[model samples]
Target: MRMTALSAVLALSVTAAAQSQPAAQALLDQGKWQEAASAGAALNTSAGLTLAAEATTAGASLVPDNQKKALFQKAQDYASAAIAKDRSNADAYFELARAQGRLAQFVGVFQSLGLAKDVKANLDKALELNPKMAGGYVALGLWNATLDSGGLKGAIAVQATGASRSNVAPNFEKAISLEPNTPIHRIEYANALLLQGKKAEAAAQLDKAVAMPAVTFWEKRDLEQAKATLAKLR
Candidate 1:
């Protein structure tokens, strides 16, 4: 009887943890980044770790510049922890790449160059783990695009990270194909198109992004950026 009771309690605990996932996701979707991170503290699952990493990185943008590095570091730590827990967790690798990318943005060109390898490696690993991970493809596309746009610095970045301009559009298109409803992919691809001097094509993509419905906090923020960029293009 005692063993049976213990098993029942264990099952209930598992169910409760599973139920909390939606609430955690809702917090993230609503842009309650700090809250989402806090909520994820109690969860030990891969989803929870990904949420914590994403929330930490997103929350960094809302904080003072001085606090940004610390938050990004936390995001990287959480993502690394997730990977340690589950090497096959594609989202964990994606979050690691994202956190590193954001951290690179705050540092100097030389520092960012060093981080480029890590960013590219994690993104690649994420895609290897899950071929259908659209976000990973988008990040990889951005990596290629950003490095190729740097001129002399871009050449150096290309040497350091081994990223190529040739891979950019194809990866973006793959991302769009994998997740057609995701507006951010369109916006990012549009940015890539503009980098390539394909103004008309970029404008079309931005228009499509503006018309798409944003279901999450990140998507809404991306939508606003897309609208602002579209205005500049027109």
Candidate 2:
């Protein structure tokens, strides 16, 4: 399935949090959900966005997928608090988008679609406020590509249109340039390429994504599945 940008934002938040081994691990071990949650809540500006992202990510990591709504709601609360403190905070918007996206994913609720759109608007505003915001573009591109690709329907669309995987190449390409190391972008792009019967190209992208030092074990496992699926096509 084509994962949404919201999913990427949430995943990125968690991944950023995991990078700080000691702090995140300590909070997790202590069951300091509130503190951890608070720490994430604090990342609302250019100066502290990274920190905030990591904290929320740590909190999200502790919450199971089935219980993600509650966790995301907490994240949203934090994000809202940050926004209240700084109305023009781009990072705050990103975090809010992440939380909403997680909630959307948890329930597959159509109402969540509007929330995702809201996220895109925030991201768009973030870019207008700061054009150098590479993360914003990456997140936006992921959301667009996922929706456009349409999962199994996207595959069928590809076949029906006879457009080839090359047709959807731009979205993934843009995403990669914005965040070359994010595994999701490559995997999603590879999926598109595979649908177009561009097996070798897809494999190459997936291989590179899998090999990234930053890719988590589970992400690597997913890449492996993409590779395995591609191999079958070959």
> Where is model 2 poorest over a 10-residue stretch in terms of lDDT?
158-167
lDDT of 1 by residue, 72-110 (tens): 989999898888888999999999999999899889988
Candidate 2 local lDDT, residue 204: 82
The per-model lDDT (C-alpha) reads 0.89, 0.60
C-alpha TM-scores of all predictions: 0.94, 0.59
Question: Once model 1 is optimally superposed onto the true structure by TM-score, how far is the C-alpha of residue 228 displaced, in angstroms?
Answer: 0.9
Q: Pick the TM-score winner.
A: 1
RMSD of 2: 12.1
Which numbered prediction scores highest in lDDT against the true structure?
A: 1
Q: Residue 61 of candidate 1: its Cα lDDT?
A: 80
